[model samples]
Target: MDTQDIARPRLSEEDWLAAAYEMLTESGVEAVKVMPLAKRLGVSRTSFYWHFTDREELLEAMVRRWEERNTGNLVARTEAYAENIAEAMFNLFDCWIDPDLFDARLDLAIRNWARNDSNLQAQLDQADTRREHAMTNMFLRFGYQKQDALIRARTMIYTQIGYISMQVHESKEYRISLMPGWIEVFTGSRPTQRDLDRFLARHG
Candidate 1:
């Protein structure tokens, strides 16, 4: 029988990863124990072990995927945008910089876990650098010099991360929403009407 013709009832590797991701987001990394993971997937522990040798291995894969998900399609699309860069920046930051991006409880729990875990710290640093580099590249594409791009990229990311770090504590979004107007601080000053006119003339 053709594979498509038969009922395909088996769960996929993606399904397994999604379940693992949920466990990580809903609870903390500590909550993603081997038994709990198998239970979440409605699979035998044997089946789980067949796919992954242990929780540590699964966590390695999870962090790798998380890095890719963050700095891959999402950032790539943001940087490749042809439309309003400001709008793209806003939407992109909104996702990452939202405390609601994942469970607040989970976020706090993971933050604590990361402080003690070397692997987790390394993964976080890798993610941060990749994100910064991607944003820096985008700024460079917009005619910024390499030094200016690095400064601006670092400024943008730190500002967003700081906003979200507080967002989880405050359970509010208003402050970060007001960020764009603050962009002038990154620049020397607010753009003059003449400056805007000149910039548009060149880029138009």
Candidate 2:
């Protein structure tokens, strides 16, 4: 058999992006270079250009993924159906526990990356504003005054972002135990027994 006839592993754009995303969450954006990713994927460095034009393109794709997965899910969750504001909040809280709805690691990675990148920082600010607005609209939908809605939305978002930035660790059980108080504080109403039951069942 001729060595030239042997086939190298075929890699997809997602394969490259996934490797970059992992490096991003584990190390930092600086660690997400093409050579490192190619090495990690066991592919030729040239193979990267087949998917992305360059490192900058790959980085932008990562940002798009973060925006779509984290910010998109958050906005959708805020608009999820519920009988009242407190129940509505429980829907949003699911983002804290569900990685599908919110990739906290990616969010944190982007924040850290933005510290040294002004353009990315601008994008992050825009995303934060969008998320805050979604929460504010959620509150307004349930009859809160515009001023109160904005305040509560900022409070909820800032508190959650703080938890992510601080890398707070807590057991799911422990966090669930605190849900009622947190919900009441954010929504200005304690969840009814039914609301708590529904929320608990969703997690359970």
Candidate 3:
């Protein structure tokens, strides 16, 4: 291994993963190329191969990291909420819908990559499951039965994707804020400041 390769081992796995996505957010999927990524880390090319087999493997690792992140956020946020539908649902949406919270570029890159790779499709499905499961639990708080919750969760997941899937030229902040009103139409209750505060006071 090169001396730089030895130094590369000092960086935590999370640090490396974050650097990869930070690059992705800056330049798109192509930014994560092995040689360039190694160079970006001030390490040798062999350093990357030591941690991952190849560029494709590293991309998959990145995908896995993002999937766990969204899944973990969903699980943690859902468990923290009180038995209030509107408040819980708003919290749930905030997890994925926030502009600064999630990197929309990450999903856009994966969706683009999926057009040429079947494997990426599976990773996309995993992320979808995470969101659906989390939102389903929120629906349960809103008085929906398991099956009904599952259906509603699926809808919520799609609606969320559609919202985020807007063109890069569109306003992300505006898109994130637009969903709550429609959510009220779908769920029959708009979350209010008082309701959210009560739920937070109980659950927070």
> Which predicted model would earn the best TM-score?
2
Q: Distance (Å) between predicted and true CA of 188, model 2?
A: 1.7
Q: What TM-score would candidate 1 get against the native?
A: 0.64
- What local distance difference test score does each model get? 0.60, 0.90, 0.67
Model 3 deviation from native, Cα RMSD in Å: 4.3
Worst 10 residues of 3 by lDDT: 195-204
Writing each residue's lDDT as its tens digit, candidate 1 over 1-204 gives: 334313444556676667877877776677878778767766655556646778788877876665555546446645654434454454454444443432333334455567779878776777678778887877677577999989988897777566446754432345443445554555334444443443335323
Prediction 3 TM-score vs. true: 0.72
Candidate 2: worst-modelled 10 consecutive residues by lDDT: 1-10
Question: Candidates 2 and 3: which is better by lDDT?
Answer: 2
lDDT of prediction 1: 0.60
| Candidate 3 structure quality by residue, lDDT tens digits, 1-204 | 678666535655665677788787677776678677767788777656556777777777877766666556666666665557776765665565554445566666667666667877876777778777877777786678999889877876666577556743445456445545755765767767675565345333
Clashes of 1: 0
User: Model 1 Cα displacement at 153 (Å)?
Assistant: 1.4
State the displacement of the C-alpha of residue 195, model 3, in Å, after optimal TM-score superposition.
Answer: 2.3
TM-score per model over all chains: 0.64, 0.94, 0.72
lDDT of 2: 0.90
Candidate 2 ranges with C-alpha deviation above 4 Å? 1-8
Candidates' RMSD to native: 7.4, 2.2, 4.3
